[model samples]
Target: MPNNKDLPVSPFSPLTIGPLTLRNRFIKSATNEGSAPGGVPSKRLVQFHESMAAGGTGMTTLAYCAVSPDGRTLPNQIVLDRDTQPHLRVLTDAVHRQGAAASAQITHGGCFTFLKPQQAPRPLSSSSGFNKVGLMSGMLRKQAMSEADIQQIADDFVRGARLAREAGFDAVELHMGHGYLLSQFVSPLYNKRRDQYGGNLENRLRFPSLVLRRVLDAVGKDLAVVCKYSITEGARGGHTAEDGAAIAQILEREGAHLLVLSAGMNVESITTMFGSSFPKENRVSSNNPIMAAAMFIQSLTAPKVDFRELYLLEHARKVRAAVKMPLAYLGGAKSLQSIEQVLGEGFDAVTMGRVLIAEPDYVNKLEAGTSRDSICTSCNRCVAMMYTPGGTSCVLGQPGDAQLNAQPAALI
Candidate 1:
């Protein structure tokens, strides 16, 4: 097995993300396990991050914190309203205690929120409507975003950032990619507006930039701001890697400290979040054994054409050349050697979702030079449905009652 004893240790350098200094470049990409409920952090969520930090991640980001109520894909997805701060403090404290910087990703679900109906449903692209994604029910109603509503949502991002800071988070990442609310506004497939918020590149990017400005004002330069933008949305007719770089440039000009590059928005129906369109074989936690064949068939014909959150090798290189700001990449990277290569290639950092979920100690294991197969099978079971009945819990990540203790963050 791979362990540090034999492998070359890529100098565990000190990396600065905004004002925070990380011991290493390994970051736990935000994975929503439904640990937080009602938009508040649960005890289980605290433990989840604590374990990841204790396992030695340089930094970790809180995934799926919705900026607006209607923008949620699952009811259990954390809501960052006035009521959420109380529960968030616990999780933030846990991350800090373990010596890892904590960042919160503020997202808006737009029309795909089957979780909870937002008090307001302002769709950026009324023509295409909200995207219907995997294991989700009901059609998302599409409504045009008024200038007034746009302004409000932008302001809401600032509000959410302020709350994240108050809860003691080290940084905040705006969820502008992945066909979410901001993504809908920026994507060519979703955004079809003629106003200042749409049209040319400048116009299409207006709202996102404005939101960043507001967040900066509310949080100040003392706070590190990050934006996770799409490199190339999995589906066609969406923004490309080139467009992703332009968005990065916009965020940098707006004073963002970092940009996280992600790809394949709303491609979960065919591929898993890790971008694995199909697995090599049926394993415990991957796409169900029975349904797995269909995905394998799809992969043979259209692996690169369709979105797969798998390895980011194909797109990260393109993005690295386009912008100057520090870039972090997220897809489904599981190989330690591959991760080292990704950073060596130009990505400032690398993130893992299910890989980390399957092994929260992934960073520490890599540091110690341990070669162990992840328990997760790339099944996408956790994401098959928004949130399991109550909050969220990964059956594969948190196997049986024994795994439950290791996954306390699911209590909410």
Candidate 2:
């Protein structure tokens, strides 16, 4: 257990992040809720975030809001656009009513998508290569992004941020981590380009930096612009801890309001990011059999990492020393003790996913001193729930709960 002594600030303290101020330092990190159907936020999705707000989180993030239609990792993922702004507004308003700020995580899947050619012909990525995840959907390969593709995606990020502001989001978290489009560009393991956008750290960062600058220019005044990126890609030849710190410094220079420091890649080193081995029972709930099979096969060889409290603290501290911008630590924070320890370590805030999913009101319990630790066992069943018809939920909760059993939305 972390000694809670000599902490500079409590997790309950308010934090200012550029244009927005959180009521407390605890933020519910982005977790794809799989509730959006037809690329629009559903009523359940609104209620999902509302629960987090009411439970006492300073802010709750709507996860994986793709910047463009073709950018979605799944057909049902929400897309931030004119057509969905009203639905998103409803979500943000609900969070505001509970006195918690709302954040939209704007992202592009890049080559990580499962869309077929008929749906997303020529899916673009940093460099063209065989796409293992896309193989199940017949999207066997990805196209190396051309100059026009790069500019168009950057424009899409601007539009997404603009729409997020229109939707009443207090912030827009640009997802540059988790082996997504931006992450692909940053990792040498994925980016093998010989053009100006490749070959070195500065070149790899060029595209993501462009996207961040464009979004900040468009909505930095209206909403806090948070950039979440991996501090380490967690693979042998991928971005290292030093590269992560350099990325943080560059982002600070680029004017990101806050940095959410994370690690690992969804494609190459997911367990390293989450600090847990893949659960064997994870195959039962997927709506897509092909994806289920892929996950199962991957699990067989997925690197095993024992779950530990504050898993990313060491790497995050390096980033903290490299940049003066406010930093949010994400990964393995499950208790008030851990949260306090992270804050004491100089992080401006702590972002949690599994604990929040396990108990939406966990923060409230901590503030009241009613609970010192979360009941989450880190079984990772909730991770599997992300692909379920009902979206992510704690298996420890009662089965067949209506909110956890919402009818599956038809895939676009």
| Clash count of each predicted structure | 20, 0
lDDT of 2 by residue, 1-412 (tens): 7656554888898999998999999999998886876776776787789999999999999999998888888888888877887778878888999999999999999888876533446778899878766756677788898898899889999999998999899999999898899988998988999999998988999999999999988999889999999999888899888899999989999999999988998777878888888777787766677658767776876877789999888888899899889999998999788888898888999999989899999999999989989999888878777766666788998432345335322122
For model 1, where is the 10-residue window of minimal lDDT?
A: 281-290
lDDT of 1 by residue, 1-412 (tens): 6765455436256678777677888778776755654555566667778878998888888898878776677655677875777677878888888888888988787765555344543333323555544223445556777778788788878888988898888889888876677877787777788777777667787888888888878885666788887777766677666776677777778887888877766533234225654434322234333234334444554464343333666677776787777888777667766677677677777777767766788778777878544555666555532233332345554442323323433234
User: Could you tell me every candidate's TM-score relative to the true structure?
Assistant: 0.82, 0.94
Worst lDDT 10-window in candidate 2: 403-412
For residue 144, model 2's alpha carbon misses the true position, in angstroms, by 1.1
On lDDT, the candidate that comes out on top is 2
Winner by TM-score: 2
